[model samples]
Target: MKGFVKNYSGIIWLLTGIALGSIAGLIFGKKVEVLKPIGDIFLNLLFTAVIPLVFFAISSAIANIKPSDKLSRMMGFTAIVFLATVLISAILTIVAVKIFPIHEALGNAQLSEKIEDSPFAEQLTKLFTTTEFYELLSRKSMLAMIIFSIMIGFAALKAGKAADQFVGFLHSGNEVFKGVFILIMKAGPIGLGAYFAYQVGVFGPQLFGTYAKSLGLYYGFGAFYFVVMFSVYAFVAGGIKGIRRYWKNNLIPSATAVGTCSSIAVIPSNLDAAKKMGIPEYIANVTIPLGATLHKDGSSISSIVKMAVVFALFGKGFDTADAIVLALGMTVLVSVVEGGIPNGGYVGELLFISAYGLPIEALPPAMIIGTLVDPMATLLNATGDTVASMVVTRFTEGRQWIDKAI
Candidate 1:
């Protein structure tokens, strides 16, 4: 009974924080403007941990696996799952926009003028062709960080006994970053409360429903994607019962991700659940953490859906070729690049808006609607990670390679 109460307390606190924040925002939204700073602080804390965490975690995980044959296989499997997920998401976004257009009734406000002032196009161009060091320390780019970490890790592994001290240092750094992540996440209720209040104060409850419908459509499509993909994993690896069991064990982690709207905060629980479900520890360690950092089916999908909404609102009819290309490219690139960054959805959406030279006035509306849609996006991301893991596990056939000390 005591344990049950303790477990329930976390959920209660999360709900209470959300409620209080919303109420506060509704009452003093325009005057106080307190939520943005608090949210920013929260984001800062998250970003501080991202770089070191990615560097250490990826280095350590890759260093432990041997023979290098399985490495190629794992990379291939991950790439396929990542691309497939993005494609499905793009198709869903296109269909949703066609069927239940969001921007149909919005007021006509010229957005091109606003788009010209923003830095999104420039940022996108920079991302396509930047040196590793420039991207890592200067731009703080996620793709750059992953590439640098992987290269160093591979080097460390190849160095034999000489790299032992350096590998130990990375492992220690990973531990420290993980500890910091926990400390920050414990304050989640407060952050959620403050942000929610600000949102309600600024937008009111009526806007909630409108945003919710768009979010609902995205999640509905995401659910379809998850089911279909998991069915394939089941057919390939285990049967229906195995898949069902996997889902049963994963429910807690999934629900936590949905409620918190944070895959980073849910990582420990996800790792634990993966192990309990009989996923090999090596696979779980390598894939789950890597997936959390790289696989973002939800954010990629939501970016496209939101872009469609923006177009509809502006009365700009979709260009079939551009829309298809944007949806597919944005989903994959954003999923891969933005996955490691904190506030990934926020950053990804801003980048998307800027990249396409969308109007700035639309940003406020996008921010409001985007925040509302985030939890669903987080849910999709968490589910995508699970599906990716299952696929990788199957592809690898649960084979265990001996870990060699560098």
Candidate 2:
């Protein structure tokens, strides 16, 4: 139907592009590698734009904050719950990948750099702060830029009325760069399609196996998290009665999220589910919307899986303690910023590449994984908001609030 196409137009176009490219790769084999330059141009544009885009988007979101006592309390609880759940998801995926390692399905792409030896203190300094401002302009300095941006936002907040104009400028810049990314994403289908063609041509059919294995890993764990973890959260929120009410009312929201492949789109369904589940209006109102932007358990899981696949392909061991810690930290950051802009999935991809110091050639595969995993990710991201609202209610209103609301 027309409505269906309208809703999924972006996905349709991308899939179509990938399909066409795959056919070309199949037919021409290595000859299709000629199309890689087009993909490189697209990746280069993204790399060039992402640093400023991150600076403005994060800074503006923080700078525009309007403080209120109730809002602060709610936000404090919400941040705790959101970050905790996302971390839990990341940790679970790490455990799973260790048990059954992600196979190198994308052929042996020599895209990763060997992590340089450095003292722990030195590495920490570089991760959080750059020596010069110009260094923040590079994607490799992503975490440092994030730290700097947050500092600026908080400083602007501390300035009060005097910084109002500056806050507005940050907002304007965010919008401008957002528009710039949109313009770039208009070429996504062609670029990604060509990229896929080259990958399939060079890597051959094994590419499909890697994609399938990673997807299966994510979906299997995503389902477990959705079913088991949510039940536990609901029980913690309201006991046995809470679990019943949550599942009874959460189906529509889950369906809407999976169907739309968008957390923002499922807001209405989530609100309705929250109301039906006996979440306080204030809690649901704040948590659902904020969670759409901030909480992303599914993305955390998928990002870990993507990193595992990339590590396997690059002949690196992912089980190192330092690597796991860094992946968890990066996963949390990626989840927070995942929905910060249009075509924001690419932002997460770039973040992973930069944080891990992988070459830009690693981006296309990461992007492909993100696209394929989006619907399930949206399912967890959107529905988790509703469950998180329940947890917030338990903390703010006590255990018996659920009984009282019903």
Highest-scoring model, TM-score = 2
Candidate 1 residue lDDT tens string, 1-406: 5644564465466567776777777778655465667755664665566556656767775565466565677767767876776677677677776787655543333233222222445545454445545557432355455566778889988987899898888778767766776677567578666666655675565545556667777777778766675566544545565466567777888787866667776788788777666666767777777778677777766777777666654445554665566557756756764564444554555445544545433444454455656666777777667656766776676532111100
Stretches off by above 4 angstroms in model 1 are: 1-15, 34-36, 68-82, 103-124, 128-135, 138-140, 203-206, 226-406
Candidate 2: lDDT of 162? 99
lDDT of 2: 0.85
| Number of clashing residue pairs, candidate 1 | 7
Give one digit per residue, the lDDT tens place, for model 2 in 295-341.
98888988999898877666555777887888898899998887768
Q: Estimate each model's TM-score.
A: 0.61, 0.95
Clashing pairs in 2: none
The alpha-carbon lDDT assigned to residue 195 of candidate 2 equals 87
Reference-based lDDT, each prediction: 0.63, 0.85
